[model samples]
Target: MITVRCFAQIREILGCDTRELLPAHTPQCAADLLKVIAGARTADLPKPLLVAINCEHASLTSPVKDGDEVAFFPPVSGG
Candidate 1:
């Protein structure tokens, strides 16, 4: 299974903080996985969405597999 976590406003938009996807439902890369997770609400998500896989920063092209924890969140701005 792939563990997906949403944060900040994304959580509100998606109506959930966490989601679980079976390996059969997930794609090869993070980008495609995002699409599957976002579904028809892709445009509803914030821009420049950040991603982390297994607690480390990852790119959209990053390879993902079963048992990986994927997190999607908006950029953080702070002084």
Candidate 2:
């Protein structure tokens, strides 16, 4: 089971922090998974989401395996 975690804007819109036991198909990559969570709407995904897999920074194309932890969050900026 894949673990999906949403943060910040993504979390607020989805109204959840984590989703568990995702099927090991369809969305085989981090970006595709986020698109699925965003209801397949490109606009909903916005841009430049910070993603991590198994606690390490990863690209949108990173493959996800069963039991892998996938996390998503918007970019952060400080002045």
Candidate 3:
């Protein structure tokens, strides 16, 4: 199983802060994880979404395995 956490606008969009998915329900990459979490709303997700694995920044294609913690959020901007 994997733990998925959504923050900021992402959490609002998905209507949940965290979820747990079995490996069979999700593929092996961060991209696939996003698809599973977003489902049909995938297209409505923010463009250029940021991803992280176990607290380290990662790309959409980053490999994921059981027990990994994945986080998704929109890019942040501050002055």
- Per lDDT, the best of the predicted structures is 3
Query: By TM-score, who's the top model here?
Result: 3
Q: Give the per-residue lDDT of model 2 (tens digit) for 1-75.
A: 788998888788777799885665564888777776776454765578789999998988998888899998888
Writing each residue's lDDT as its tens digit, candidate 1 over 9-61 gives: 77888887888988765358887778877888989998888889999999788
**Rank list by TM-score:** 3, 1, 2
Give the Cα-based TM-score of candidate 3 against the true structure.
Answer: 0.89
* Ten-residue stretch with the least lDDT total in model 3: 21-30
lDDT score for residue 55 of model 1: 94
lDDT of 3: 0.90
Ranking by lDDT: 3, 1, 2
lDDT of 3 at 60: 91
> For model 3, how does the per-residue alpha-carbon lDDT over 31-54 read when each residue is reduced to its tens digit?
888988999988888888999999
Lowest summed lDDT across 10 adjacent residues in model 2 is found at: 37-46
The local lDDT score (0 to 100) that residue 47 gets in candidate 2 is: 74
Worst 10-residue lDDT window, candidate 1: 23-32
Q: What overall lDDT goes with each candidate model?
A: 0.85, 0.80, 0.90
For candidate 1, the per-residue lDDT at 34 reads 80
**Would you estimate the TM-scores of all the predictions?**
0.86, 0.79, 0.89
